[model samples]
Target chain A: MTRFVVSVHIVPRQGLLDPQGKAVADSLRTLGFAGVRDVHVGRHVVLELDAADAASAERAVREMCSHLLANPVTEDFELAGVRPA
Target chain B: MKVGVVSFPGSNCDEDALLAIVERLHESAVLLWHKDHDLQGADVVILPGGFSYGDYLRSGAIARFSPIMQEVVAHARRGGPVIGFCNGFQIACEAGLLPGALLRNVSLQFRSMPVTLRVETSQTVFTNAATAGARLTMPIAHGDGRFTADADTLTRLESEGQVVFRYVNAAGEPTEAANPNGSMRNIAGVCNPGGTVVGMMPHPERALEPLLGSTDGLVLFESLLASVKA
Candidate 1:
């Protein structure tokens, strides 16, 4: 078994209202960053676990994202990276 | 009838729910801890309001994995009466005991005020005693109480009478101005297809007395009592 560190990024699903992101974008526009199109606030989670290999570790984290890390109904998750810990 | 109010790590309204049943409805009630697996033979279960798990990872997301939730899920699957209020409603959605999801309030504000709700249906166990068109006032305190679902689900809920309550104006009409947190279609409460499980963002237990502003919440407790007895 190898210890692997996985990073996952979860974001609000498209077409759903992201209030915090909107607030941030509004603030950015007020700050003179007129080029801002939009922003969607979400979350990033990092986990360290022992798995047989990198593929298994990524697969396991994907399962975690579907089951608990990210809400399937409202959020989408993707693995940002995986590395030996 | 015995009512069980689950007390999660940060739940603040479990006692209010218990008292609503015992003091107002004259029914027996108990507090079930999040770590315990037993329901104590409770006939009805209430997932009360408050910031369970400190609203981590989207409100009730984390609390849904508590040890007691497994038993609660089983109890719900057995056709037991279950109701979730505010944070409890979020938890119910996370647990899949109810459909849809609660997103961050569109106003980006933690709304803590009383709002008017039009009882859309009295067919569910939670609102059986309420008139179909009755207006009730209750308090809602949450930052993530905006209910959202797919377009198809919304259409089905509307057609099948799953939408039990809606935010309404003083004149009892659902309007954009009446929606407290930008919930879709101004929905304030909903029930499962079977009408046995219900979830709402309003804190009915907090409005059980006139001194607290309204006693309209008592009708919900009365409805439950009547349903269980029947």
Candidate 2:
């Protein structure tokens, strides 16, 4: 089995309501962080796994996103993984 | 024999849930509006999805104080099996019937997608029909599905095996990329001390038929029915 490094973000999918993100953007501006015009929040996750190959691991990771991790309708996942160092 | 789908003012999934429970499964169900009390003799109370009160003032924050929720809490306290989905999960947390709060999505966006759930424990009525490590594919639609709790509570919940399901990847694998809402430790659903009441952000009732593309969720409803008969 090959070990790989998995890094990804889990965010709300487009078209669903995001009242919380809007509130935070306003708060950042209120706090005098003016340079930021648009802000969206999502989780950044890093994982290490042992698999036969990167494709297999990616497939596994993608499955997790579709079935469990990311909600398909409203959320999108950006992921990249490589063989462990 | 009767399934109760609780309906808050803005809840849109009541009828859909009822159809899944009755038409697909051939079981009897009732739509209990938020104002009505008594649960209408429902054996299992299911809190369906929707943006209650328009998701205003935080997801499910206001609905926690609804009249029926009080009774729901009382009923759950007495060891009745209650299932909460999506906003219902948020309301359950708000009412202190379950642990953790459903915060805004990590990306601060609304999420509507199919999620794979890994069954962490199958001791409860809802999950008993499946094996402990069973994987279920279901749809989860919510914004504040990020689950957060105090460190102590988190430890206890983990130690007691209260975690029911976790979001995973498309191939039915458990990994970080699939965790849609940034739930703590990838926690998607949990139960109370009694284990009878379970709250989950994923909509199991939403996937009771192949027309929706999966029947993995039907096991939960069947388990509840079995308990009702027991």
Candidate 3:
């Protein structure tokens, strides 16, 4: 088995309302960062696992995302990185 | 009728629900622990409100996995009435017993105030006692109460008349100004397609007595009793 480090990024699904993201965007613009556009806020989750290979680790992380890490109704998730630790 | 109240580690409204059921509604009520799988033969199951699992990893995210939830899901699947209020609403959606997700309030603050809710339908066991278009005052207290769902789901809910309650003004108009948390379409409550599973962001159990400044919430309890009796 190989030790792997994984990074998961979750964001509100496109077209879903994200009040937190909107609030941050408004605050940024007020702070003189006018170039910022469509600012969206989300969650980043990191996990450490022992799996047979990178493919296996990625698959496990994906399952985790569907089960708990992200809510399909209002949020989407991406498995950002899976690497040997 | 026997009512079962599920209590999670951080649930604060279990006692209130019990008191309301036994004292006000005159029904036998029991507390089901999160780790317990048995429901004690409750005809109706209620998931009371509070910061379950400390609201970690999002509200209701963790509590959905409790051992008792399996029984609750089975109970609802068997067509038993199940009502989830406030944090319980979040748990129900997370558990896939209901549609939509509750996001942070548009104002991003923990809103704790009495708001007017218009009964959109009187067909379900939960709202059968309320007249169509009747407005009732209920207290809402939550930071994440803005309910959102995909357009398709929202359309389906609207078409099926599954929308049980909507935030409204005193005159029962669903205007934007009356929306407390910016929920889409001012939706305050919704039931599943079967109408056996219900979820709402407001605390009906909190407003059941006259001393609490409103007796409108008792209508929901009364409706439940009426349904169970019939």
Candidate 4:
């Protein structure tokens, strides 16, 4: 299987509010966790793909990010890694 | 008029903003790299839209620390005009040039669509050419376009007339959907207390050309032209 390292951050676009992130931080407090302030939630996606090269793989995933994987308005993604299996 | 467009790494709309200023508006402008600390005789500095520094840490968080931003802050403090659109707006906030932080939308979706903005104040150079009730149609593409501010800050912005634009309906009524992002008080744009620095989430450059659909954004440039020409 082809192994690739793809780091993606599900950040809020300009002017959007992140209630989920706020909720998570609040939950951590209820779990007896203190000193947790200004908590922001993000994502990391790692995939194994058999593609032609890194550029092509990134292009595919970027397209996926633009259309399927992520929302262009509220979130953004950067894709990398495509090696032969 | 000499204009400069700051291009931070990963800036996708620097070219679009430049074309609007130089080509459409028939003004001279340069593409300034983020590392450059010099303004190079540029009268107006534009921080264009698009994800900068790959939106690492925050949308405009990492970019705020860029060397070019230091110059921008200094220029604005010197009574020079500075405009930050979308991601650029985020950087301005991160740099403390403006107030509030951009957060995720309530919908939690990447929203790319047209929006309506009502000009709240026209005293600044950016809106000097327009009537107080001018309406603009522009595109907003971002996940963190939601504007958030504390109650005290919001009150101060309102009392001081720092807010310049608010999302409105086609008939000029304020609405929630018109905001696109769940911004605090439906703020789409704001200016510094000095009115030299303005930041907004809408892409006015995208609306400059009628061929692109709406030309409402051109008036913003026209307003700047009329002011800076003085």
RMSD each, Å: 0.8, 17.6, 0.9, 11.1
Each candidate's number of clashing pairs is 0, 34, 0, 28
Worst 10 residues of 1 chain B by lDDT: B50-59
CAPRI classification of candidate 2: incorrect
User: Which digits, one per residue and each the tens of the lDDT, describe model 2 over residues A1-85?
Assistant: 9888877788765544455667788899999999876666676767788888888888888886665455443467888545574
| DockQ sort, best first | 1, 3, 4, 2
Candidates arranged by lDDT, highest first: 1, 3, 4, 2
DockQ of each: 0.87, 0.06, 0.85, 0.09
| Chain A: TM-score in each model | 0.98, 0.81, 0.96, 0.64
Q: Which candidate order results from sorting by TM-score in descending order?
A: 1, 3, 4, 2
Tell me what fraction of the real C-alpha contacts between chains A and B each candidate also makes: 0.83, 0.11, 0.83, 0.17
Q: What does candidate 3 score on TM?
A: 0.98
Over A4-82, each residue of candidate 3 has an lDDT whose tens digit, in order, gives: 9999999988977777888899999999999988878999999999999999999999999999989888888998899
CAPRI quality of model 1: high
Q: In candidate 4, residue B43 scores what lDDT?
A: 96
lDDT of every model, 2 decimals? 0.94, 0.81, 0.93, 0.82
TM-score of chain B of 4: 0.97
Model 3: per-residue Cα lDDT over B56-162, one tens digit each: 98899999999999999999999999999999999999999999999999989999999999999998889998898998998999999999988889999999999
The better candidate by DockQ, 1 or 2, is 1
Q: Model 4, B11-114: lDDT tens per residue?
A: 99999999998888899999999998888889999999988989875678778778888899899899999999999898888778888878777677788888
